[model samples]
Target: MQRYFIDSNVPESQKISIGIPHYHHIINVMRHVSGDQLIFVFNAGETYIVTIEEVEKETISCHLTERLEKTVELPIDVTLACGLPKGDKLDLIVQKTTELGIFSIQPFEAERSIVKWDEKKETKKRQRLQKIAQEAAEQSHRVHVPEILPLLTSKKLLLELAQYTHVFIADEEEAKINEQKVFKKLLNTMKINDKLLIITGPEGGLSRNEVTSYIEKGAISGSLGPRILRTETAPLYAMAAISYEFEL
Candidate 1:
């Protein structure tokens, strides 16, 4: 069934209303009309089987037939703290990671990052990414939409590290990351609701000085693989591995 996320308070009545853009999608692209069925999710575990009942100028009304509980969300909260990458690659990162059940994403300024969002534009950038996260969450059937937070400097990120229990940075240079030790240890030890912070560097990669700083913060090194991965791909790989490590 075609899926869309709606506000949590969507009533349990036979009829439900959708906003203008969604109406356009139903009327135009989807060609949905009366009697067509769709899926509506709160994206935090409440799903309704909806049947199109009425199509109006700016809204499409649907009828709720049944509801189901969602079981797809990750057991733990995973935060991706990525060093701002250049160009449009971050768009892919935000969209795909939201689908993978990441709890939140943070963009931090690394020493070698080529693209910099200054004090003024950082907030706007984050808001845009958050919108993308919401859309991805709806499309991917995620239980809860992931967050895209305001920018942080690497130093600022390190300072806030104590809030999370499992903190690891992906270092292509690290030998320990390749071994099963860090992941195995995480699987054996961490609790379900434990917060996992994953930090990935930028296109220029983390400088030696920056690597030293992260290492000092008790961030154990984890390697992705043998090939040279792009800034965006590395985080996705790391997140998938983390999901496999704990939830599998």
Candidate 2:
């Protein structure tokens, strides 16, 4: 069954009226009929099996059939912050990380970032990523859709560090020196529901000054492993390791 993330909560009446974009996909793309069953996920992280009761020109009415169990979200909230990379790598990161159960994603300007966020198209780019995350969440059957935060500068990112319970950075220098336990140690210390923020650099990697600045913000630096992963690969590795540790 096709899945959709709804904008409102499932009311007691158990009737949901879905309109355009969703209605278009149901009627035109998926070619769904009035009796076809689908999944509707609400903003509150609730999933329901809904049956299409009526299909009109501009809207589709769905009656909730059954509520599904909710256990797909990560035990702890993990946000991945990436120093903006080139091309469509950020799109891959957002899509994959959402499937692996990230709480949110933040892209910031690092000292070595090659691509700069276009001031005029910033909102457009962010909306594109948000759509990617929503689709990924629905495809992966995730209860919660991960958010794609607006672009920020390193200084602005530092100011938001206080919101996370723990912070870590993936540094190539740390990987070269075999500094591995900091990330695992931090994980071991954290209980369920803790919010963690991890940062990865761009293709050129984070500058020494940027690393020092992150350290000053109380973020522990660690290596993903002995190998130096690419800018886009590092965040995915971190998220997978987190799932292995907490979900396995």
Best by TM-score: 2
Deviation from native of the Cα of residue 125 in model 1, angstroms: 1.3
> lDDT, candidate 2, residue 59?
94
Q: How high is the CA lDDT of each candidate model?
A: 0.77, 0.86
Which clashing pairs does model 2 show? none
Residue 206 displacement in candidate 2 (angstroms): 0.8
- Residue-wise C-alpha lDDT for candidate 2, range 1-248, written one tens digit per residue: 23588989887899988997798887898788989777787987787778899999899998998787755876679999899999999999999999999999988999888888788777888999999999999999998999889899988998988899998999888775547777887886775468999999999888888888878988889898888798889999998988888656
Q: Which stretches of candidate 2 lie over 4 Å from their true place?
A: 1-69
- lDDT string, candidate 1, 99-167, tens digits: 778999989999888899987788778878988999999998887988887788988988877888878
RMSD of each: 14.6, 14.8
Score residue 99 of candidate 1 by CA lDDT. 79
